[model samples]
Target: MGVSPDTAQGLLDELFLISRALRRNLAQPEEGRLLPGGISVLVNLESAGPCRQVDLAAQIGISASAMSRHITELVADGYVLRNTDPDDGRAIRVEVSSTGHELLGRIRESRIQGLQEVMADWTQDDAERARHILHTLRSQLIARDSRNAAADHQKHSEERIDVQ
Candidate 1:
């Protein structure tokens, strides 16, 4: 039989708790130079190279205004560089600077240290399985998002036709 609604909700709650714990442990302090939100943007840029601001915002799952504010903070902190998108002059693109890359490395190290501490009692196999499970979950989520986006686009197109 398919999973029950209660079982699915329980799994979602567990995932949310895991996300909260990671953010609590790894997020930068308010008094610190970097905000956790900005750091996340920097990390994404560091790995993804330059990306259009709107596209980056969508990928990060934040509203455009929120991403703009995070990008402004990151720019002020010298952790990222903003430039005109060569392909689309009206659009802005962002990339992590050298300083940002260094900061990202430190952030990654800190996260690894935190995970190590939390998983100290777990065996190597447990850690490996957890990593694999997370990867699978991420892939599934991405696929679901793609499907939703396509459906939304189709609905909007039909609405426009009806309007006409």
Candidate 2:
């Protein structure tokens, strides 16, 4: 009665690919200036302030080692600065450099311009509705994850009681 599982998956993958291609083509950023991953890290730091490597990695959905490597690259690029964490003397903190902020601002403006051009024909109401739907979808996903976690916890508790 509804869409088949395979068909649904195919549609989702196709849409993701199309969106990635559009972003790549639309954002004609300067060569060797900044990539999407670096920009993403910068934006997160800007919002969350200086963060530990592991914290940044988790927030960015990356592994701790991978985050360290990325942070190394960022530091080398002069876009990110590193310092000792005063609260955790053994750990390090990273913050976006002034250059990084400037680059992020430029990227944001460029992306906005590209999006505006792409949706030039769409009405403001349409944009607002799209934003609302996107927020709703995100919320729904968070709720689903929370429910799944609760279910898993219950199963684990049941197993422990049975063993006891």
Candidate 3:
């Protein structure tokens, strides 16, 4: 007897539109070309301290080969530096370049501007309440996903057998 499913879907649709516009606005000011995935790798490297490529892939939710390709581009762009892992002779690690850190700062400011505009009409209290709700929603979603991922993966694997 609460909100209808159709109304919920309409809300989701509006959220997507807002998110897309925000992303576009965030990407517009950056002079350098770093795709979202590539910038993500930079951020991970900056925070995670030069982890092995395999571990970075898992942390970033991308395949190892795809991480390699992304690293290739990031290195070529001078936003990342890769080296042999001193502790592990067989493994490689990557770190964000000084340039990458500088760029990340700039991009972060640019990204926040769009979000600020979206909330321009809201009072400080209203913004705080919205942030709390979003954080709560995200945490709940992550918990739910962790519980369901194994079942979903197994179901996909079973479905893949029929396709093959």
In model 2, how large is the Cα lDDT of residue 145?
Answer: 79
State in Å the error of residue 18, model 1.
Answer: 1.7
TM-score of every candidate = 0.87, 0.78, 0.77
Say which prediction, candidate 1 or candidate 3, comes out ahead on lDDT.
Answer: 1
Candidate 1 lDDT by residue in tens digits, 5-124:
999899999999988888888654531666556767777777778998788888888999988888899888888899898998988889988888887777778888888998899999
Q: What lDDT tens digits, residue by residue, belong to model 3 across residues 77-128?
A: 8888888889988777888888878888888887788678877899999999
Q: Candidate 1 clashing pairs?
A: none
Q: Per lDDT, what order, best first?
A: 1, 3, 2
Which should have the higher lDDT, number 2 or number 3? 3
Q: Enumerate clash totals for all models, in the order shown.
A: 0, 0, 0
- Compute the lDDT for candidate 2: 0.80
**Cα error, candidate 3, residue 115 (Å):** 2.9
Alpha carbon deviation, residue 77, candidate 1 (Å): 0.5
